[model samples]
Target: MQVLAAGGDLAQLTASGLFHGASYGALGAGFALILGVTTRFHFAYSLTYTFTAYAAYSLTAEAGLPFWPAALLGVLAGTVLGVLLELLVYRRVAARSGGDGMMPVFVASLGVGVAGIALLQLVWGSQSQPYYGPSIEPLRAFGASFVNLDVYQAATSVVLVLGLAAALRYTGLGRAVRATRGNPGLAAAQGIDVRTVYLVCFAAGSFIAGVCALWYGLQYTVDPAMGTRPGIYAIVVAFLAGTSASPLRVLLVGLGVGLAEAWSGLWLSLQWTQTTVFVLLVGYLVIRAAGPLLPRRLVGKGA
Candidate 1:
């Protein structure tokens, strides 16, 4: 509380907070969509979705394009890669291994992740490229300087969360997705084309992840292995959110985690910041997994 009150450096804190929040928000959304819509190959889809966006940003920013254009290109490339992977790889693997069993799919996803990272390193030359396109104008609010990029990132994240929530809550496509998630076999029997739904879900998830990558790249330099940490953190956030399929909840959780991390970094050492988040996630997951064993009234009673 004292440290926060002192607010060692408001400008740096705000900038870091916004980027971290935005990055985690994108991750949470991507993982939630994958888990909600297509449970069989969520990890594989996530890996591709994240890495493609990272790659796109690296390629475009290195080429000296504007940030928006670079971000757009990243999103497009991620969408394409996601669709291709779904059609060419996951679809075939799922078919041969029997869709009911997820082990083969999980293993395949791990393989894909390994291959993807290797390929990324090969093409991107394993070097960190500085991301420079446009400088964000600074503004003063309440006697503290704030970077425009922070506001932009925060706004974009909020907008995406709202838009996604609206689409899922009030759209026919959303209904189809829910139906598929509830019972893919039943949805297929009803002529809903479960495969197509999976494809679409993967595409959407990838697109969101691409946006995350673009924003992340814009703030920090691009590196071949950049997606690993954020991807892992996203999966953790999704798990902690209790598989609720609520983007708002996920966004809030991400932001909370971000703020907590920022505060920790301010008061503690940088090395301990990530450690604190990991501990929090572990504790949350333990409590969550134990919920089913507790009495109904005790579970989530106050939360």
Candidate 2:
């Protein structure tokens, strides 16, 4: 029984990992927009994700609202907050600092993330808040088990990933985003508002993240620190996919990451989940770093 529960079945592990990866894909989709388009990152963006979940949790738990409406409103609040942070805080910092570099922006983001998590703790306490909404029953088949929520989560992530890719490829805003990502200065010269693109990315990213957060609230528990670890993993996915790549590629990379972690669970303990991600990241970085110096044939370059 213990062996079966761990990683006995490859099919089971792959199914589980794909579902887990769906959440990562949703998160990476949001973060990728900002990182790829605006060329700015906020450690605090994950805080926005947490804030979205808590907002809905508060409405449902405290105000006695239904789960769906509360979640919808929570998404609005989070989206607004994200835009505000970009407009009020990030923009002002950039203006004040004269757009010198990313260092100031990152510092400011880290500071906000710390402060935001602390505030969540103060207001909500340190308890893990789980939703008691409509129970999504577990589904079982092919010697595997999963929940209906996992299906919804995966479907939603797939739609969003495809939507994002289509928008970037075919829409007016997509053109602007691609242009800004490629060369902000040239984009501005072409009459694109780089700042507006940044704002839009924040709003869009935050909204998508909020939706993803809502799924987490339904399926799992929420806490002030809920977004911290997942946020780190999403950042890794964003980098792995890179700026200007197909957003659907983010989904594929996320699935790969999930597979790696899930397979690792076959032998490793539960506590080692995060370590797997970091190990993969480090391995990728090492290979890239060495690729330049290795012989062309060995590196598979000029082939």
Q: For this target, which candidate reaches the highest TM-score against the unseen true structure?
A: 2
How well does candidate 2 score on lDDT at residue 303?
A: 21
lDDT per residue for candidate 2 within 1-303, as digits (tens), equals: 133355347677888889878878778878988877766677787899999999999999999998889989999999998888888888778777875746677889999999999999999999998776777898987777888888888898888888888888899998898899889999999999999999889988898888888888788898888888778978988777664567788889889888998877776776775689889888767766798787767646422
Candidate 1's TM-score? 0.86
- Give one digit per residue, the lDDT tens place, for model 1 in 1-303: 244444536556655665687668767877787767777545655556557556566666567666667667778888878777778876777789774646776777778877887887787668877665458687766545666766676777778778777877899887788888888889999989888888887777788777776666666767766778887778877776645568888888888778777767667766677877788888876776788787867657633
**TM-score of every candidate:** 0.86, 0.93
126 Cα displacement, candidate 1 (Å): 0.6
Q: Over the full model, what C-alpha lDDT does candidate 1 score relative to the true structure?
A: 0.72
**Candidate 1 Cα deviation (angstroms), residue 219:** 1.1
Pairs clashing within candidate 2 = none
Error of 1 at 291 (Å): 2.5
RMSD, one per candidate, in order: 3.2, 2.4
In model 2, where is the ten-residue run with the lowest total lDDT?
1-10
Which pairs, if any, clash in model 1?
none
Q: What's model 1's lDDT at 65?
A: 68
